[model samples]
Target: MIRAAAKNHKDVLVVVDSQDYPRLLEFLQGNQDDQEFRMMLAWKAFQHSGLYDCAVSEWLWKQPTVGGEYPLSFAVPLSLKSSLRYGENPHQTAAVYVDKRLSEVNAGGIASAIQHHGKEMSFNNYLDADAAWNCVRDFNNPTCVIVKHTNPCGVASRDDIIEAYRLAVKADPVSAFLGYTASTIVDPVGGVGGIWLIWDPTQVSVSAHIANSQLIQATVKRENFKEWVLAAVYASPNPGIRQNLWNDLENTSSLMVRPWLIAGTILPIS
Candidate 1:
């Protein structure tokens, strides 16, 4: 992520996915209203430039550890993705930025995720989410990963998806307060589980959310559950992700079936 050449002004229109060509054309034809889509495109345009600028800085940072002198001035330009209520504390200010390079190469990850439902994510939320996302991807079987404060509170991979999730939380029920869950098994088959039956990973889940304290539990509803075989049940920890309880789940859940993308949520220590 290197220059602000792709920056978007107030009057500009930006679209990255070619699949949106039909939608863009339709929007131009005045067939519908997509104010939210317009805003998101403008945001992506700025991120394009931010990625370029950050690319330059990323190169500079690498030099120091590679026997080269550090740059006289150093800076990283990241496009703001979301703003946290606070940083590590209430008095501090913090926000999350999208990695333009990562977005360009692959548009699925914690940073570029689509939030199905959740409260405003905190900085620590991002950290723990990142941890959970990576841990689940580490397996190729029906798996579940539970994370707390950026640590692997629990992780299990089993032939049975429900059992996997149960074992993960049971690994540390006290710390099993999951804000999100993930896995990478394609053709992830399923039988009757506790709440629902999920037979295929490709079908769209009819989410019948059972919202907990701060999270909306995933309870996929279908007129014919046996036919669709699509189900997803999300859960969360105590109450601030331990306080907020249930929050943030879409990223890892949506990414579960996308096999092309193996791993990308390695947040920088800085």
Candidate 2:
């Protein structure tokens, strides 16, 4: 029996009641390519981390398979962590965490991602991006979203990915030019010309590029369900930023004032 309750069954795989740390590591190292081996590895990882034992599981429903579907489907478990985003306000702070398993079968291939650049994402960035991407990702076409503060200044869905860019530009060209453009989370490609950013608190100017307008290629609305959200605590204090600061702040929400914005959707005033 594949016991998911790690806290309850911590000793199930234990040899002679020992924690078996080495054995655990060995097991993971071995049979890495085997589908069944991967499943076991996933369970063991969850058990060791206490996610299945101490943490709550999400998206825990069963589904049918293809061709009138057999009852057997994957019970994949995915995890999520909510980090501190400077807070609801720069002064106020908050956090939200979840353990959502995206699948239950074929465990060996799962892995987490690491950010190489940009400012740290905040609670609002997650929420707004979740909402923003959810709206555009299903288009079976490429789309672009310009988010100011946390609200959607521009969201365009079309057959041509460029058209999506044009729509976003048309919605709020001024804000779109300054705001962040997030792709999808599952995107193998890290949106360079158009993507999210991290606000450097020390420097006043946010990191960006002038040629981002040129690299856009393809026109798609097929919706791959990948996306990202972006925001800077504040714009760069550079002369270029200074010119747009008022408009950026006025057009976009204030991280200091408004902790988050759900682009393309209504946000309740706190």
| lDDT, candidate 2, 1-270, per-residue tens | 334433334333422224556755777577543444344544565555544433332223222332233324333334445455446555556664443433244221212233467656665656666666656656666788777666777887788888888778888856764433443221112111122332323333322311121111111122353232233222222444344534544554432342332221111212
In order, the Cα lDDT scores of the candidates are: 0.55, 0.44
Question: How accurate locally is residue 139 in candidate 1, as Cα lDDT from 0 to 100?
Answer: 89
- Model 2 bad stretches (over 4 Å): 1-82, 95-100, 103-116, 177-270
**Which RMSD values do the candidates have, in order?**
17.1, 16.9
List runs of model 1 lying over 4 Å from the truth: 1-77, 178-270
TM-score of each: 0.41, 0.36
The true-versus-predicted C-alpha distance at residue 47 of model 1, in Å, is 11
